[model samples]
Target: MPCRKERDERRSYGGGNQAQQYYQQSQGAGGQKPPPQAPPPQNGAGMEGKFDDVKPKFNDVIFALLFLAQLGAFIAISVISLRALPASEGSVGLGQSGGTATTLNASTAWLLAIISGTALVLSILLLVLVRLFTKIILELCLLLAVAMSIGYAVYMWVERYWSGAIIFTIFAVISILAYPGMRRRIPFSKALLLFVIRVAKFHPSVYVIALIGTTLTAAYSAYWAISVVAIYQKWSPNAEGASTSGGTPSSGAVIGLMVFAVFNLYYTTQFLTNLFLTTEAGIFGAFYYGGRDAKKVAWGAFKRASTYSFGSIAFGSLLVALLDLLRAFFQILQSYESGQGDIIGAAVACVAQCCVGCIAWAVEYLNRYAYIEISLYGKAYIPAAKDTWNLLRDRGITALINDCLVGNIWTFGSYAVGGLSSLFAFVTVKASNPSYIQGNSGLVACITFYAFAIGFFICHSLGYAGLSSGVSTVFVALAHDPEVLAERDPQLFETIRRTYPHVLNPV
Candidate 1:
């Protein structure tokens, strides 16, 4: 009985061991591997694994060759433009009939040559620079080249030659093609190119708008030119005769004037369009802000923008009017010296007319500014009527009257300065050319040009000022108002608080 019991115990132990072995095999078959153990460290060696391998797909040499090829193309086009000039006139002799003669002095030719050369060198440099810096400088340079070429073409047209036209066309084509190359060098250029392309392709209406604006601008310029010419003819018949001494207005002078006129028209249209667009853009910006509960900010920005714009226009209009009076004075002097009595008297009359016109214009500008301010700030004062009643009654309206009176003094002072300046110019021209006032007509034209240019420049600068003020005001207002900030963008609010805390809390 003891032996049999021992055998049973042995059988049970063997069976238990067999069951454990089966369980291990089953675990392996079911993919239940043991947790991975780290590899053992090598004996005093840093690493045993292989280093990462990389393969070269492109050669640096090929890239260098491509860059050189592109640079060569740009340089070649620039060289062509620089060497070419407007064709020489077929007719010779000063003041002897036929086509207007072109007298290209050494200085003028040298300047043109230099411009062309610089454009070429810069274009090539820009190509390389673009590869490195990836900015729009190259594109801007190209645009400048195009503008220069256009100017050269106009010069040719005035000379009645085809050489300039042909050269301009060729350069224009090159610029267009090079634009794509420019895009490839810069990411933003590519994006801008795509945007313009998309606009051309999808929004043909934009072209129509541009065409309409251009047409209107041209018509306005034509009307202005005709009016000026008619006035000149009516005032100074002798000056007209002098202009025809060379059998036509000097082609160069005429071309120069036309170019000046065209540029003036373009700038004027651009100015008006910008003013309109700014207001629209501001309104849109404000509306967007208001939608986010930023109405006060928008209104503030609008007020500032309107004030600056109106102020600039008022100042420019006054300045131009003053300059015009000076110009008229010079014209009368020129006419008198040229032995043109009818023209002298006529020029004097025109000066008188201009003075009247300027006064009206000044009043209009002031009224416009006043209207805008009143509409924006709300009206609370009357001038003459209120003063008479207040003076008669001896009421406490004195402070209010004083404020209104003081507010307009500076504006009236500006008008007074303008008038005085005009008077000075008129007297100066009359004094200088007492014998032949007609001879000073040329001086008048020159002064007029200067005045127009100055006014435009001032107006342009003011537009920029307006834009900057508007942007700053909007950003500042956005920085404040925690609720608005939170609703618009919590992240942006935090960023503003972190980066520009002082801007938000200005002392």
Candidate 2:
């Protein structure tokens, strides 16, 4: 427990400086910080286009080499998995028709299964070790996750609709180049030494983050799978639709499965994502503001996560879930369109996919940073989200995110790495199968991808979430009281500058 003197000091962090002035004002009215807008829009204004206060440093390379490893893992895995996928009706699972299962020799089937199963096990163990022991290795894995996520996004974009891809590609370029206060990109290997220092200094918080995120992910995934399966059987008149045998399934069965699958994934993912993310932030908050006792800090994080941020976390999760459902629904439509020739489905799918490029990225970005503030102040969701956005804008964190892709990069890598790793298993299975099952490889690959992806994602979240929160906490702490960071951990305070040159003294 912190001594009385420390408690008195922490109280001061709540207020008593220029930084807290805005923070104080934000908390009053749902934490809304109105951008400086001139009243007359016709002549002079709307929202501020650029950050007025923040000046961020460029050339941040916190996890560059790690990102490359992630990229290679994803690419190699994806290429190998591609061979497991048969060129014919094997594509039917998500969009295509269900035909014959791919024939694979017993040995081949065993090989693929063993390969994927091993990858899954190793990935989990690797993530755990990275979190608890090897900080650099953990980051490398995290960056791999980010690379995968980005790859998946790209694949989704160009896979179904070329036109959509072309148009969005233009928008993406414009968004990147035109965004104000943007900085130059860093080397893929930038800032390893600096990031290593940061990680070492805060590994205790990282450990708690890893454990909490992993537990929540496992719990949610199990709950989602069991409930979704039961719901599938409940809605389907015949339970045989549960089996992927060559039998035809009613559209209703597929729809039931799809609806539940989409919503529940989003629901569970959002909830766990928020819950763990908030915990990650709180853990960092305890350490950055108060000195660390891993268990006590973790407990404090738990209280705030369950009690204070409960409402916001639930509601915010719903929004992300719905948005994801929208994205997934479009993909499903596109899948069925080729064979069904449902022009209406095609049209609607096209419309649905129009915003695919931006919406997912934006929603993800908001959920992540918003949770940090939500955990920090014990504020409600909307206020916390608004305050977080305002703080990012005011502090140049948004620019850092947009230009640097510092925090969210690992998520993309994790998604891709899992897919690629699944692919690796898929190829190995095909080579081992004497009969060479055609379609089954894709199914196995998909399983491997999801299993590895989900677990790896949660693991990477441990690293990424804490690090991002650390940045946010430091920014807020500095703003509220510049000396707080310097006084509490002067080494960390200086290290922050090396990591982000744009940071200004709050005083």
Candidate 3:
């Protein structure tokens, strides 16, 4: 009913009043003013732009193709090899002689088969029964043994034929590809190629070592074969008074030696390959997971392993030397009783003991240190001091020592018993034949003591290395907590876990 301009004014005033009322209501609800209205979202142009820059850098298709090609090639080769081997050859075969023949001795084959089969079945059946610690221990031991054996073989091969293009090629390729950050400047493919070429150049040196190791191993194998034959000849009714015909070994003996040589070669080659691969893989894994900064950790682990192995060898050699010296002293005393031979036998015995001791100690030390370093750091070096030290202190040194004491009491105790038993045997043998005391008795006693020492060395070195490596590997695995340590030490976390349970759990 109002005039047109007055009506417009009234409408404006009414709109203002309505807005005021709404605001008042909102404030009354919680003493807060209404929030400002948000602007409508724009198109995701920023996200798209960022992705555009990244897309060209990665060729997912190429990566997938390469991975598939490698996998396929491996599968194809494995299948072809498996098929090529005759079923009989793959399995065990009876020799021409009445005695059974197998890839391993009959006893060994049966024992391994039974043990492996039982373990597999039990693992499935009693999956919940076995402790995690136990499983880890078993896996670790197996892994260490395998790795050591592989490393030894590879080292021997590399030492022999390292100068060759093929050897250098493999080594270089592995070093580049398996080591991370190394491929950033050079494409992975090119780096691998360069590595191969470098390794090839070292084949001559590698071949020399391999040749020497093979020859020595072959001689040892021959000795082992001859010893078996001698024992058989002594024990077998059919072999009575049967000396090696015309100074030529029997066909069976020759075959035995050949088998030993073949086994030694295969084991040595496989071990060396494993060692090289494992070292490279450890570094690669660490670098990949820990980014550019983990190179030191990888190198540390490698060096530590090398150091431990060398140390063990050195220690074993020293012990052997000491025993040899004692043998020499006894030999001299014996020669004096005989009044025939001079000091030559004593001197020879001392020199032989020293040489053997040195070799054994060196090998033992190397084996031990290698096992420890690998088990503790998952490589050789750990950058995170707290993490590394904690792991070593808690799991490696502490847990391993505890486990060793518990696990190896039997091993050490058995050796002690054996030594005492041997002493008793020597005394009994001497008592039975008082005549043995006249001239060569001292020499015989020295020989017996040396034999005991050798046996003890073998048992302890092999046993402890196997046990400690296995246990430490498991503890490292169990201690891995990605949420806690992964951001800083992801490589350590991942690799420490992947060392295969069999290596740790030797049981």
Candidate 4:
């Protein structure tokens, strides 16, 4: 770790000045990369050696058991609901079927399959592009964000929407003015991204895991959709003529089943997402500390994530899942209140929705670092969360700025892929003229939305998650033991020091 004295000096100076002074100091009189030098080894096990010393044990066993029970319940519900799906002909549309299939049918199923396939391909391509052209891609994403703000401002002006125009104009100006400072961070960001890419490439299991995650999420999404459709077909009040059974439609039962399905959907997705992130974090942590074979490290990480630490992942995931479920519920309430012209009720619901969403975001952010701790140290969720919170508080500014910059790259990339997928969905539906989508602009819109969402989800899972895990693991590892990097890979440390001198100093 860099000396506390230097860190105090950095704190003494202001923002950009701190970075600037550190830059000059790093350059020295010769104005070149710092000479490679390893930090002195600490007592006890070396960072890499700890992996062998620590014996893995199951953490948060109760949460793991609960998660399994939930999974079992969801599976049972899905099976029962699916068995109740009405036999279908060509007819498929929303609302009352009146003796026809109203819920999703074979055509919708095919469409989902196609959309999933497209998303998978696009996500893989996105990873390839980021790896091959990290800097260029990053630059383009930044430029595009600024350009879109300017363009939107211009359009708003043309349409005589003064408020819209002014707001966008201000945003455009601020982004443009801030470009220089943002641009300066790109080199370091690019280096970090490239390192992560190289790590993923070195251990191909990372990609394999990503592939499995993408496929499972997409398939599960389809299954969830089918389950919802089946529930509506069998239990909805409007389904009287759609099914052969003459049982009266029970609205209460329908709502209960729907809620259960929705909750499980959120939980399952969150669980899988955290699982993959935890696995990747382990791989990156191993690479950072060195001394372990890449293959062994990767396999070991996956095993730990899927077994011993599974409950920790599940526990963290449950927090986010519950928040999301509440957010969704509030959103639905807001919509209902708005439709009923209950202005105050709608406003309250909207506010509640926003609050829940923000909380979910915060929890998810904490989970990112907590999972890193779990992956590296085999700690339970509470301990991992506590340590992660402490680390963030101590070194958050650097991590925040770095995350914001890199996040923009992936966010824009995912949006681009999603937009393309939506376009593909639109064109495909139009060309095929599916009975459900034909003549129904609403259905068309819904399908396109699903495509966009699935594309974004898949891209985030396969590309962003892997890379982001690498970045988070690096930060966590550095915070815990900077000496490890300095000892194992002095050259990389020097490169990091060149771009961000503050990194050398303890935060």
Which lDDT value does model 4 have at 1?
55
lDDT of 2 by residue, 365-469 (tens): 776766776666555566667866766666555443443434433443454445555556545544444232343444554544555655455545544654555
User: What order do candidates take by lDDT, descending?
Assistant: 4, 2, 1, 3
Count of backbone collisions in candidate 3: 87
Which stretch of 10 consecutive residues in model 4 shows the poorest summed lDDT? Answer: 14-23
Q: How far is candidate 4 from the true structure (C-alpha RMSD, Å)?
A: 8.8
Native-vs-model 4 lDDT?
Answer: 0.70
Top-scoring candidate (lDDT): 4
Which regions of candidate 2 are displaced past 4 Å?
1-205, 222-254, 292-295, 340-348, 354-357, 402-409, 412-416, 424-456, 466-468, 488-507
Better of 1 and 4 by lDDT: 4
List model 4 lDDT by residue over 153-232, tens digit each.
78669856576579879978987997788887777677676777777777777778777877788778777776676666
Scored by lDDT, model 2 comes in at 0.48
TM-score of each: 0.27, 0.59, 0.26, 0.80
Looking at model 1, residue 318 earns an lDDT score of 36
Indicate which candidate wins on TM-score: 4
Lowest-sum lDDT 10-residue window in model 3: 50-59
Q: How accurate is candidate 1 locally (lDDT)?
A: 0.33
Candidate 4, residue 424: Cα displacement in angstroms equals 2.3
User: Cα lDDT for residue 257, model 1?
Assistant: 43
Instruction: Give a tens-digit lDDT track for model 3, residues 63-111.
Output: 2343335335433432332232232232232222233232222222222
The C-alpha lDDT values of all candidates are 0.33, 0.48, 0.33, 0.70
